[model samples]
Target: LEVRQCLNHMTDIFDLIDAGVSPGRFDLAREKLKKKFGEDAAILRMLEGDARWIELWIAVANTVKHPKKTERIVVNDLRLLPDRRIQLPTWQLFHSTRCLDAPQALLESADIVIQNLLGLFENLFVVVIDQVLPALPSGLQWVLDDIPEAERDPKCPQRYLLSIGMRNARHA
Candidate 1:
């Protein structure tokens, strides 16, 4: 459930990026983005390359959001195999639409999804700096500062400070 929420939140971010309709709808946001940016856009190409995994995640998230009796994530389930081997307690997600030969471990899957999203965000940040930032109108422009390695958060090394004009530059 939490994983689904996180993915949905990402869609919200996408909607914000579009600055258009579809507040929390991933499908609409994705389509609008492609239409606005064109298929050849770097951001769109990046998403296109990761389409498979993204679809799998969407399926998993959807399964949790609208759960059916047989198609539900199994949390910390332990199983005994036919050969009497013990399977450790593990989070698993299974749905027929996105069938896995074996159940996918949820923790690892969630970690992968998050890491991929973060990587995509990092790439998008570069696009913003190179393409979007320069196009901003005058006073609306923000000053961007890259945090020093030693001062940056370990988990989020790409952290930067953005302030509007010199008045707030002292904070950075």
Candidate 2:
């Protein structure tokens, strides 16, 4: 559920660059961008490796969000048996073009899932900062701000601010 939401948010970035791209359809967006620009486009090359992972994540998210009659294989918990062995979630892909013969555990732990999401976010941020933002009409781009002491948590140490000024400019 959360993964799906995060993917949707990520899709918004692509949509901002080119309107009419559907949310959570990064594959389609990639193809559209590649076709519009070219296969040799820098951003597309940078995003090539991320496409597979995003597809898998999309499959996992969709399977969990919209289950069918034979799609009841979402195990999402870590357990330790008396034998002292760790057991991770048994997440699998059901209806993805990735692998149709048989499905395997795509996501095992929350840590990995979070790490993947963060990695994708960082890559996207770099692409936006380097390529997308400068081409925007209003020059609107993201800014990072430190979390206030009153609202700060160890887990979340910063917040994003969308600024309308120069790149990396501190908005007062």
Candidate 3:
């Protein structure tokens, strides 16, 4: 029941956010989306962390609703193009999406909020892994380490912070 209400609220909020996004008002849209997704995720976790139906339905619904886009950012294969047509790397694209260019004030506030959030979770991941290690099998023992580094679990908050800055570096 709680999960249902949360999902319905998230759906409505996302709709309003989509309607709000545009070239001129992208910052506003991003702020709203960031807040909505952050709160919604935490609430969703609390409400339905054990619901198999919600899990299956969300996975199916994600696939149906957001058809994946295979974006290719390759440099011009045509030999006629200039250097300005240079391929924009994924990291660059990710950084550019941030509101850093908006203003200095916005950037400072963002830094403060991010720092505070980090402080709230300081080293808790280490504790979680330590607690789980004894209960896990030797074969599956790598789950703790692999989990911290592997493909971001969509439902995880740590995965959310795996930035584009570290993404390519990690692969390299």
lDDT of each model, Cα atoms only?
0.64, 0.64, 0.34
Predicted candidate 2 versus true structure: per-residue lDDT over 81-154, tens digit per residue:
68999765455444645433343344634567777787677666655554455554555555545346577466
Total backbone clashes of candidate 3, pairs 3 or more residues apart or in separate chains: 0
Candidate ranking (TM-score, best to worst):
1, 2, 3
Which candidate has the top score in TM-score? 1
Q: What lDDT does candidate 1 reach at residue 50?
A: 66
Ranking by lDDT: 2, 1, 3
Q: Write the per-residue lDDT of candidate 1 for residues 1-172, one digit (tens) a residue.
A: 4545555565544534543444335456557777887778776676667667767777777887799987877776778989999766566667887766465565676678778877656655655455444455544556667677799788767656766664434543
Model 3, runs deviating above 4 Å: 1-107, 119-122, 145-157, 160-172
What candidate 1 gets wrong by more than 4 Å, as runs, is: 13-24, 76-87, 128-131, 134-152, 159-172
**Total backbone collisions for each predicted model:** 0, 0, 0
TM-score of 1: 0.62
lDDT (10s digit) by residue, model 3, range 1-87: 232333333333324224233322323433554565554543234323323333433333343354444321122232333755633
